[model samples]
Target: MIKASADALVLGAGPGALAIAAALSSENLKVEVLANSDPHEPWPYTYGIWGEEVDDLGLAHLLEHRWKNTVSFFGEGADNPSSKSNIPTPHNRDYGLFDKNKLQHHWLSQCELAKVQWHKGLAQKLDINETESRVTTEEGKTITARLVVDATGYDPVFLKSSESGPVAVQTCYGIVAKFNKPPIAENQFILMDYRCDHLSEKEKSEPPTFLYAMDMGEGSFFLEETSLGLAPPVSIETLRTRLELRLANKDIRITKLEHEELGLFLPMNLPIPDLKQPVLGFGGAAGMVHPASGYMVGGMLRRAPGLAKAIAKKIRDSEASPAQIAQCGWAELWPEDLIRKQALYKFGLEKLMRFSEPQLREFFKGFFDLPSSQWYGFLTNTLTIKELVSAMWKMFVKAPWSVRIGLMGMQGREIKLLWEFMKPKIKN
Candidate 1:
């Protein structure tokens, strides 16, 4: 059996894990990554991020498409075959579609240069002591490190699941394909087009979905039918059918397919890993994916460096024990302020998931009507709890009577959650 040790050990090689590896390695710590897949494999998912986030990550060069304005279409008019007025609001925030092909190679090359070790294997078990953490691989390899990070994406074997029942999920299917003409607008992209004409009567029984279309340049555009939050998740078959129907409505013809992006199992409202266990969590395992939007790559990238630095500091602090170090690092990743922000976001997700098709249209109509800061902050997961609550209140005030009534129709669990979120902040 092979045995290895390092200053830190990262499980999983997704964007979150890789980012953590790079960050730690740059800190001059010995870091090794373990995952089942090859490090060179291209990420199948195409990521969209606010342009500024990409710039901060030194990944602006990885953007293949950029849009100055983003628009959201909602309301019954959006679902109309003839009504072109969906009451679109153009936002000032810049959006970019990443070149996933190049991004994987770029990050991988950076890791290599930083001397991050790569171990290709599935992590079967994790063991921790007061001084160090150990990992057992499926191939009978043992790895020990001062700090063990579970950047292992969703469905982690190392991290314990906190939720008893199913967690909320965001599911999507997308295609980068050729068309005779641009299927969507030339320069602008639709972040969420909640036109209902694409769904059949049977499909309408399920939760509402939206079209997330991007202008990829050339004759190709990337299009996705996305379900923002669902318990079991909307199936791929349903999403594909919805996408085809939406394309048909636009009279867009597909010539060739270049790539396919399918996303599933984006867990929301999962428990964060215990910091005192000589383990740390990063990426999805740490609940970094915004509960409302299921967008995480950018946030993960932006925070990874800070997390790495925190770990390095903990290791160098002679007085800090391993448990104390883990606790400090966990706090760095998810501080009290951020936890509050996440709760507000999750509350937004819970509220969003309760809407029916027509109700969804009505709710979103009110949402896009929000001021740029509120709407943008909510979508990008950058809003403070106060900002998110202000946005929610504004949306509630602006919503039609039906949507207002729907907002009040929270179930028992949701009501309990709302109470939990409020009780802590109440002053005597």
Candidate 2:
């Protein structure tokens, strides 16, 4: 069966797709969302974002929890106050966790009120033509639209994988549980606690790792052991074991289990969509995730509305052919300035993957030692080229000899990948 046509067909019903769909429908464009699962299903993973991001999206009302400052510690006895190097965020650095249920409900209500259509089925194939693009579903239904957008998470079927492969992966396993007493302070969030408290000597020597803990209120916590970056990715079992050891060392007994989560991201730079095709990619498939932090929700929230407006404007005013209108959307998403930002972030990820355990300690030591604006900008994906270069130079100046040696030891393959990512920026 062929259904009604739309001005836009967005595949995937996650926050990214819904945000765009809602924005487009508000502009009086006919938009339909196709998703493989229940549209109301709650997102399992947690997210942390800068307060400014929440303000930009007008979503401060949806915050479940907030902290004025985030803290990080590094090196031996990091858990002990006396023997560790610490970095307490500057006074202005605030972070918050979203209330997933309320947030999704808000977006869904907006979409419903705007008259956005929803379909439950897997998108199977895409057929692009001069006038419109067609999508076929597993249920044998066809959807034709002036434009097709993909927000289908990490490995989108619509996107071709990069030949250069993932520069690095951020992996973790964690649990949400009730404790007799809170494991962390009520008002603080632990960004990265690198103390080696519970591990045996052998386990301690395995790799450089840290714990991410946040007080979720009401005598509960979201706690996990995370490996920031690895080429092959740290195993889930390893992360689990480390988390268990860390919790046991703290004598934090779980009274009841609320949920479990696996955080996994293979950070890579995606190729820009060809303007000749009537397709656009958003979210992870479009390289919207921050390579350094593996955060995308805030970035997508910021990008979706602007992109929707661009597409809507093209449809109303371009008077150009459908293919040309699609080109306008592609260009809006990957303009030259955005491309340069992507290259710089990808290069930073490549540099991060070169550190050994000892060098990594030295690395973060220097990282937290930098000016607040520089470190925070790097973390938030808000750094300009000038700020990035300034941060790098400051970091090199403060980095230990071991860290410097690691930087100088960049191998052939990594160098090739770095060059490839930088090639476009160089030309421009």
Candidate 2 runs further than 4 Å off: 1-4, 78-81, 85-92, 262-277, 317-322, 417-422, 425-428
| TM-score of every candidate relative to the true structure | 0.91, 0.90
Which is the leading candidate under TM-score? 1
What would the per-residue lDDT of candidate 2 be over residues 117-152, giving only the tens digit for each residue?
898889999887666778899899898887788878
Residue 270 of candidate 2: its Cα lDDT? 47
State the C-alpha lDDT per candidate. 0.77, 0.74
Give, for candidate 1, the lowest lDDT window spanning 10 residues.
Answer: 419-428
Q: Quick one: how many clashes does candidate 1 have?
A: 0
Q: List RMSD in Å for every model shown.
A: 3.4, 3.1
Task: Please give the lDDT score at residue 42 for candidate 1.
Answer: 70
User: How much is the lDDT of residue 11 in candidate 1?
Assistant: 90
Stretches of candidate 1 off by over 4 Å are: 1-4, 56-58, 77-87, 200-202, 423-428
